[model samples]
Target chain A: MSAFNAQRITAMQWLSRQLLNQDVAGRYFDPLIEPLNPRWALGRMIATVERIEDETHDTRTFVLRPPRRWRGFLAGQHVTLALDINGVRHHRTFSLACAPETWQREGLIRITIKRTPEGLVTPWMHKNLYRGGALEISEAFGNFLLPDVEAPLLYIAGGSGITPILSHLESLACREYTAPITLIYCIRSAQDQIGAQQLEQLQHKLPLLNCQIIRADQGEGQPPRLLQASDIDSIKNIQARHCYLCGPTGLMAVATTLLETRDVPEEQVFQTFFAPLTNPLTDTAGGAVTLMRSNRELTVDSGQSLLEAAESAGLSPRFGCRMGICHQCSCRKTTGTVVNRNTGHVSGPGEETIQLCVSVPQGPVSLDL
Target chain B: MKTLNETQLQRLETGLDAIREDVVSDLGERDARYIRRIIRLQRSLEVAGRILIPLSLTPVGFVAGTASLSLAKIIENMEIGHNVMHGQYDWMNDPALYSQDYEWDTACDSNSWRRTHNYEHHTYTNIIGKDRDYGYGLLRLSNDTPWRWRNLFQFADYVGLSVLFQWGVGLHELEYEKLLSGEISLRDKGGFLKEFFRKGGRQFFKDYVFFPLLTFPVAGKVLLGNLSANLARNLWASTIIFCGHFTEQAATFHEADCENESKGQWYYRQLTGSSNFTGGRWLHLLSGHLSYQIEHHLFPDIPAHRYPEMAPRVQALCKDLGIPYNTGSFGRQYATVVKRILRFSLPERLTRQAA
Candidate 1:
């Protein structure tokens, strides 16, 4: 009882400090500690797999019962699920699915995972989880949040990239903040959509959200139907607005290419690519040039980064700072000529020049790679 | 031209000529197409006051300045000299030049920068073999090269003096030219006598004595304007320059390592070669886009003012390219410099470098 009373006092004092805007995290944590250290916070799994939906062969959704005393996260925060597999520790990040209000009233949370080929964590998650299974979780982290910008928002997601968007939707639902939202969640097929029921629930509950799940594999849509470069044609008036992208690296690459083709300033392009980048410099904003010494090729692309196409074709090259400052990424043209978009610097000398680290591939450009 | 020593002047001209040639060749002759425009822009800003004085003649001055004390006569002595090089008069119909000074309300665009700043300095940054910013000794801003023996004393000299200049602006200037002459030049004797005192004198009285003492603060707003402007420029411009190449984190590449030199290599050298300071709006706006040193290095002509707008794209690109784009506020950048100094000074053999 005495310990309980002291705990109550400490909680109240902590609440007071929060209201007073004191540095709480710094007051407790070792400031010099390396960021990569395991961050373990005690969180209980209250509810488990209410139901499962097989969106594809490898993806599923599991509604969870969080601890009654557990605090909910703001929309868009990610929680790390820790699982002890054969006494070895493993953790995987999952986006929260429950609305903050649901945490208050229902004391529940939801998370979805999709199995990627050869990925250890997701494949295991798909096969083993059971109803009401306890899950250890880490504190919520990540900066994917809605800004105060009152402008109507457009969200683009590819594959499993919908996780954070789902969290954002739940948060908006909890806050009762009315803002128009358009989500173009691209999937391989109609059956590939993972959170259809939850999305339908959001669409029904909040009339302000618009969700469009593009099915590329079905081949039933109009031109640029597969979420290609022309998908951003409708956002011409969105000058100075924000763009949030989350998806497989290739999808992000395509989306970025589409945005750049529309002449959207590089500043407005918000992208996050979560897959392996076969060619890291695909859709560059600009830096270091790639040069082709002998092959018959052309290099100039306002659409996709020049370096990306080359690397995509399995060319090994050396480059850096695709943003444009570092010359380490420079290449030389033993024969052809190229132009730089950033400083308007061009150096195609058919003899020895370089490809900018960031310039997207335009035509059939040759490279020394 | 007569005022400068024959041989010394020739060397300076030769140095600049070679740099210009590299700029044209390295950048793919794009400057060839835009050379006329850049030159015109440079000339106009150089004679700004001469023409402006005819229109508004009053002791109605006091605008804050952007020049730095460590930079020597940057405001007092070298203002007009740089103006002559930059061409501020081009602002008549040009919004680009006007926006260059937009961050600091008291500041105005002057010409010296188009050639001296925007073109040469930015494209070249501070590679000792190529960049003018690379002075001898510890005057190094980049770490791509290893420290030479001579730099041992120079480093001590710079740290001591640079720290002092960071405190007292005026006192630092009077002594800076002599101090810099030792390492940055093959022949250090000329700039102090001919270039600094005489050349610096002509521009000083016109900018400081005539502009500040005679014409400024007269309208009260002008005085407030000049002081604020000067303060803004000093804090913004100097801090930006410092963050980009001066911080201890910037590279000091060796003459040998710069092999297989190409434009992209140069770009990477400059991009990874500089440091970014973590600071406030005063630091961000006044210092140009230096807070985004990594971004600016990746895209020099994008304008320092536009860097904030480019941060996301830069971040995304850095991610896509798998390169580390270093940045932080002033405090963070400073802390980085402290760490850099420690690492740079450590005995080399004790360190196990990566293969």
Candidate 2:
């Protein structure tokens, strides 16, 4: 409150408490004047799943409406979404598989998620995520975008790598782009190709779009259905096009090698992986250690975060916003040094509050959990 | 640039890093308890003060009610609001104290404050043309700011700003200057205006219209009490903030001078750009631990309660490095701030001695 009219403010608050009820008034009024929803005060952007659509046997597209606090994102950007299941919050990055235009017009963005057999979050999302479910989303970020130049484009997508490419195609189709574009999507079989309907719709809308699906298991005729350098060489004007490859690591490597052999410049070929990037700290020398927290004692891998090690040991800890920003995973570091994965800043060897998600154990570190 | 040798820069970096690591390691349950307790105390005082307002027909009731209300507002704005919004105590993971979600009780929208204060002000510190808090584009705080004829009325503007600080803050990000220069149209500011009106309306109705009408026949007494308490809070807030920032010893910088600023140079800038004042524990709390502004600037995200403990160590480091640690008594620092304000009220060209 400013010096101007301070008294009336006090009386008004008093009256509000006496009349409308304090919590009720605050709930109804504060959000009107504030950006965050007071009810879900998790210090992160919250989005509600408005609808869900299964794209394939293993892939589903979730349409989410984020709160007004969200600043929105560009086409082909990925967002880190977190969901708490059984009190343990898990976070993963998913590409926005819908056009940015849709978000502006209808206030919705979609992410097509393919469940990895070993993944914790995706499998749960496939089973438990329903319409009207609320999940925490980070602001969208990533630089894998179409170049401004009107060059002919060749996109090679293997398995779930087609998500971001789908977003680019949808956005471009909406913008009435004139550049010739070709997508060769490889899956185990035709049944596993996600967003087939959407791709067909986009192809029908754009005159310059050419999409083809390659099913490895359906190669019953002349040749094997693996992407080869000769296969890319056969495409008209393949040498003049910019190549974008995304998918499993093996496919990416093969495509990159093929593209490079054809004299494609490094900058002309772009790639993005949805899998977790290998932690650089894992290469650092750290002694194997025991983590003692609450009633659990478990052996932890050197150079791995206490949170990850704890999860590996089957411990469920309360957490929110897995990034260090939220600090929901902060626990007492009572006895040893740890390196912050985000900043590479080392902690002092003493009792201190350390964010569990980002702090990699330097040695045998003891956490209060 | 202050021309420090490589050895000196390295030494400063090491010292500052050690201090940060030590303090961060020291954070524990006690710090969490301190902030949580402060929130509870502030809410309790506010509730008590508001409840006491209707009894203002009696002299003692008026005194107690206004005083309690002012105390609550002070704690909320300074300790609870400012500190929480700084990302301090964010490690607690308590939803109520989460920096991004916390909305302050002021005229300024919390999002705007985060942009202007948390991101820009803290990142740039006292760098000229960058740090908006350096006179807030109204006054000429440094000689680097070209003397404009309009600055002659800055003293009046500053006074008006203090009286309605929250309003000034709310309007800070609107860029009225650009709007006046015809760079942007009303249509461009439509969204901003809508937000401003929404937030400003709530503040106005609560303070001026709603409560006064609630008191009925004795509405005048309640209105007067609320007015006095607000004025008291504004005056104190202005005084403490000015003392920490504008005292004679606080240095200002050119943006060019801060280019490629090393971690050591960053620490040096924070030390030179902020002034501190001595006070008791209560005064420290009331000031939102801003009394140790040097410490606050050095470690903006650390809990303010730790500033007192970190101050002596930082001061010692400054002494060893031969850097001037600017600090003084509350009276002396505040007097120096007022002197600067008055001195810079007129254009420097006009204020120059006869040559």
Candidate 3:
């Protein structure tokens, strides 16, 4: 097992398995029956709205409107955002805030997008999209939403994990539900938080609802004590509640441990990983370019990475998290070498040049795409 | 009486009446005591077909092996469960004298399947007014061609995947229905309806897709053998039941007149409606008493176990009386049923010549 793969398995566990699927159908007809379905191209983009809330520096939450006919999804469920940067199309999955039924009823869909240091699709969307713009979104998909069990909910969210958790609260609150509900949302510094006003409105609206917004940016308030198990104990019984948490990489792991140590049923606590993979090309002053995706070789330009060279040669490869973290772009190097910009180390020394998101092929390479 | 042109078959009504009387007279014999023995032999052929099949174990890395094994299990179970439940072994006892198929709730009592199925489907065979197996949704499940539908302009039964599910909806309801005529206590009604829907959904899916998908072979592996076997169970299960009522030669009358249809007329209907599949006595036992559906439908009270001997006696009686008695090997009889379907589904001029 690769260190990149998560140890915990699930009912539909195949979704999280990092697979490098190239658009390989154009070459030969597939005669054998396989469960692996291919990625379809983004056809005409339906007209949509992008309501933005400006935070500091370039980060913000872009509330995207899904096509009206496209309804029915749980919060934390993300759509793969289709982008055409420099005429190159790619997809990225983002979690939607609020329950599917809410957007279904209100004629709106909301996505809380944060601008990374160099987000390819995010920067493009923040600049171009306005009300009634073409918002190219994929079909709503994901199984990470809160399960419809009878357990009381124990919500532990960090960063954007709060989106699905908030959707869960909104759904349960509407039924005037009899089940127990608790929410813990963690954010970096108070200003980066967007949904505090919505949470405040929900607190005053529902009688049995409890909301806690914890800040991790300890300046004057000690970041509200980092949402421990004891904090949830003060609110309601934890034994009979379903816990759903989503957020930063470190907080997600710690929350998973806290709940397990607290003896919450493993099935009851759910986590949605926000760590996505996308590639941002940087100049490598081409010594020699090796594209190791099949024996399919390509030249790496001083300006473009191995992916760009392949795309320029009319080979459109699939990628989700262009960052090396998501492993979506990892290809095998039958032979050759590549340099990783993040670690500044050459991986193809004794091995082959794998598509390490931000890596460029150093020499002649063969890839098993 | 009109005689079929192609064969030695004669519509000898008087001869049929005499043969019917002769069958009852011969009933004093050990094998013929119960009127249903002839049909039991047919079911026995189907019963014997279910041999001890070896299980195939699959490797863990792939899901291929597990699916095929499950399919084998489905084939075996569907045949055994259906035949055993149907009381194809006619000697089995029924506690009451009743026929029921009103989607009812009787959680209070549980011993009603024997009466509803063992008595009704066996006695009435494919009579829509009585046989629980008969379904009337857009797609009809059973084989018997309804006189009313035949007289009508449009098709009541559709074919293919989409229509198969809708027609099968009623068959699935059979698993939960209380089908009894006792006092409807509130508790019984409540318990029955609640459990019915909860469990009913599974049966609906199982029949519609799970069963079919399970038997579907994975790639590279040829499945026509297993396919043949699975289909054998299915075709055997429904066809035997259908043969007793759907054959072009089968007779029907208004339910009001079922009681008045002369004993010979009833026998004639059973003879024409049902068929005999000759050869392989061992095949008869394993497959349950399906091949002898004609004899079983004629006498529902007879135990199916005795049909092997009774079938030969019935055939002889028909021969002696100079009346046409339908008897064909399994393959031929299967072809006949298929022909009857074509006769029903196709245009009149292209299919069976109307009487």
Candidate 4:
């Protein structure tokens, strides 16, 4: 990060914006530049895979060298990785499993991915992506991050959820933070436990760090043991410790309830869900919809999709295959919740692209149209 | 071919729907891989062309550079731009391939192309006064339109349209007929004209000014090379497009006859209004898989590469349903297109009607 290099990057950024004013420069230049170096692009943030390590049978850690323009992230933040498998680019988000100091020192970040057997992108990455492959990645995002105060902490991680927790622990160790930290790492089996070496290293570095590996599977014919009230009550001064949970939805729910019963403040308990929750189909009725572009408003029933609502209001949003097979009708939902009728997935109450054909408004919604 | 009854048309609808469902469900890595590979190949050819064009000191360099650049432009326009803008790969959700976001190397802006070609033409295929794509309101492809004094010289018009096909398409949305008839004023088209100039102007400057000026020492050679390449792409794209729709066997419908059409009837109309040219893989790729124009008209959002596999199933279903499946060798189809253009250029009574 020399002054000269910083100045050069600033100049390049300005030039890129000017050239991409209408995407005319990207349209012409990207093709030529990509063939020479896939990591170089005006519009996209490209990263090259510097190293790959197997952490478990289904999990691997990818060390990536992000392009020069990447603003480094906090320890627990995640990024969306866009992998071109076969011919299609598939996007999946994963937490950055490294401390920010690592990136600052080595210009590298790591993402630990666990392959889902039936998944599309992870399996392809496991089999096809080599050491030198390039991937498109979004800038680091997510609210699950380490707190600034040196407060006692409790971390509950299930299976691959250890990724972000590991990052937090390493960051604490890097800064020589001596606050009492308790990590209850849960896995289905011993073989499933990831970042074992890192946890051991963190335990040595931070003397007060208490690491607990909990295996849910007890033995033959026994039901799996999940997070219990005892798990939280056993932690020293449970009410005082700031609890951070990342795991299966059921486990997170149980942990939250247990902490709530112990009089832990709601703001003190932070959690992130790894799996997409299936939205309940109820409550998707009689919502006011606003088309932001045309300044049109209408009320829609549960059965009517946003596409139908827009069409009924005489707004001709581009659409094809009204069944939601084609994504031509996708537009940015600027505010409020909408449920995807096709998959029953509820969208976050932030700006995100949703297919108008199949998305039913769960509440008052504003669309980019 | 005999016209299909209502029951037969329903069967046609079910059969084609099944074919489309199969391809749509099966679209994954393979289809994605195919498009990306084609894009890579196209970009590689373009890079080679741009570098070689300036080194046009030798005759071989000039010819090869022009040919490569022309091929690259053809692939970008026809295979990538046209098909992507049709929302074919919109399912992938890749920003580069997204229909609404993709602007092409061609003069025709993507948004206008989607409106005029995808919405209007595909929705109202060959319905004489409805689908402007029938003859682009230029050539007399069918006797459905009254023969005018200008019909005698439409062959020349066709040639001129082919030579400047990109510009012609760029201006297609302006609807010159409406402006001339005083139905719509040029003032109403101020926004469209501005967009057309912005997109078309960028393309003009890139080929005529920017690239030529970049190769300052051999500026004239680069300028002529780009011009030749654009001409080659224009002629090739226009010819392939003509073979798809204006061929002798392709049928035309009336707007009155197309009112409140059912899905089955819509499928039937698409079948009759389009023609396909048989060729090798290269020809099909070069044509942007428009060689399966019937399938394209029916399923405009399906990946064009998948059209090759879908074509035979569609043809078989059409055959069983007693619907006409218009297809022939490339040479035969192009010849029929030429014949249709020349024959309709004369008065209907003077030239024999195509059966």
RMSD to the hidden true structure, all candidates? 23.2, 18.3, 29.3, 5.4
For model 3, residues B1-355, the per-residue Cα lDDT tens digits are 2323322233434544454456444433353223223223323322232211112333331233333333333333332333433433222111110111111111111124344455554556445555554432222322334333442332333223112332243233343333333334446456445544443443333333443445454322214223344333343445554444445555443355456555455555556556667668545654456667766666544445556656766777668656567667767766655555555554444443453
lDDT for each residue of candidate 2 in B1-355, tens digit (9 for 90 to 100)? 5646778878888998899899887776678768767876776676677778876567898889889878977887899888988878665544556676676666677767787788789889888878878888887876778877777777888899899777787888887766788988778878777877766666667666777888777778778877777777887787788887789878888888889989988888888899999979999999999999999999988899999999999999989989899998999898887778777876767667621
> lDDT tens string, model 4, A121-179?
78888888889888888888788888888899999999888898888888998999877
User: Runs in model 2 with CA error above 4 Å?
Assistant: A1-318, A321-369, B349-355
- On a 0 to 100 scale, what is the lDDT of residue A22 in model 2? 38
lDDT top scorer: 4
Predicted candidate 3: what Cα RMSD to the true structure? 29.3
Best by TM-score: 4
Candidates in order, TM-scores: namely: 0.33, 0.53, 0.36, 0.84
Candidate maximizing DockQ: 4
Per-residue error (Å), model 4, residue A255: 3.2
Query: Could you give candidate 4's per-residue lDDT for residues B251-305 as a string of tens digits?
Result: 8898878898889889989899899999999999999999999999999889999
Q: Which docking class does model 4 fall in? A: acceptable
TM-score of chain B of each: 0.51, 0.94, 0.51, 0.98
lDDT for model 4 comes to 0.84
Q: Comparing 1 and 3 by lDDT, which wins?
A: 3
Kindly report which residue stretches of model 1 are placed more than 4 angstroms away from their true locations once superposed: A1-56, A68-71, A219-225, A261-269, A273-369, B1-355
Where does model 4 exceed 4 Å of error? A1-60, A63-69, A85-87, A105-108, A115-134, A188-191, A213-240, A261-265, A279-281, A286-330, A333-369, B352-355
What does the lDDT read for residue B125 in candidate 4? 88
Query: What are the per-model DockQ values?
Result: 0.01, 0.02, 0.00, 0.27
Better of 1 and 2 by TM-score: 2
**Tens-place lDDT digits, model 1, residues A124-154:** 6777777645555655666666766565667
